[model samples]
Target: MPNLKIEESNSLISKAVIMTGEAPSAEAVPVSTTRTGQMMWKDTFYAGEPDIEAVFDVDTEAIQLYQSQASIKYGSIAAGYSVLYAAFLAMGLYGIASVCLVIAFVFGVLTRLTCKRATAAFNTGGIHMAITSSCVRYDQEKPMVSTAIAVQDITTCTVEQRELKPYCGLFGTNKTINLIHLRVANGSSSKRYVGVKDPRNFARLVMTIKNRPRSAAPPVASSEIVFR
Candidate 1:
């Protein structure tokens, strides 16, 4: 049977298996309405109900929108300089035109390269559920840092504005998840404070997934923790 497994550092918590045959009817949950950004978790398996729910205020996502400064740098003014220099050179304005073209070419290449890096950094393409036992790996005998925060430590959560159709690029502060930065308690840590696009729905969905009955409780087979 396909089961939801959590890999961990400690053998005891290394691989906790959960029967996910009874998960919610939803095939895939829509994470962010702001489809503008790549889907965080595309196709992933998550344990059902009673999973930890952490809501941090710190927005972990590093989103990049078209900045005004960037616009100015690449705007009409810059284009005008290129045009004027090209025109001046055609009119026999010394070697100034050649220098202008070289500078433009160099900067253009640099701009393209910089944009590529920015795109890579902002690319979001995976689900980051709360850190599970598999992720902790107690067997390692060392503190673990996860890309996403653990749900168990989450005390309170709040969702702001569900109507903000983010997927459609509808702007205006529609929906937001405010979570507590877990790593903050430790002082200058590297743990990531990730965001769950739809905080309310995601929480409800997780609970449903984890809490689902495990095949009628296995018929109370033998009434023992282990059956040799």
Candidate 2:
């Protein structure tokens, strides 16, 4: 087997796996990274195998890499209100004590209301997979579709898993699947976490790489979309 070099970026945060098997006669095409953050929601893991696989072909099929939702945070609204309260308190020192208290109370109420609204508005959905760089080897007909995402777009590649014990402890009592968060940056240096089916093992494999940086990558076309 030829030592195939899978290079996405020269950064130290990208992931590449060079397995023994070659791509099934063709490289799969890339698909759109849906910005919509909605996913199939259920209380517990579905009573089935966790769907996880590499895209041999995407255009003709669907590959369920990992299903996780983005976190819907509402603390922003409450935090915003708290800022207003602080402002009111500053004014209180200027001989406007009663007015400051009233403003604080009003702002606190507004913040609470805003938080409630956030619970409905702020929600996390879907996994962030580097679809363009994730690929397999194949025939020349199936050229890999390159995404517009430049090397700067990715922060790191991560592998996730369903841990029996939560790292934070006492919060997630039940064992659940989680993505090994990869920090990928776009333009403003914001970090994003990506979830893989088996993160622990993936991380180990990544660390095994003698010299490499974590960064962006993804996959596929004409094929069977199977969810593990």
User: TM-score, each model?
Assistant: 0.27, 0.29
lDDT of 1 by residue, 1-228 (tens): 232222121112112232222333455432323313212332333425233222111122322222212333544344665886789788998588877776666656655543443343244432234433212110110122234333333322223322222332345555443321222223454232224343433333333223333455531111101000
In angstroms, how far off is 129's CA in candidate 2?
3.0
Q: Could you say which candidate leads in lDDT?
A: 1
> Candidate 2 — what's its lDDT?
0.31
lDDT of 2 at 182: 36
- For model 2, how does the per-residue alpha-carbon lDDT over 100-202 read when each residue is reduced to its tens digit? 5565566556555433322422233211232223221111111222222333333344433343333222344545444343333444443322223333333
Question: Which TM-score value belongs to model 1?
Answer: 0.27
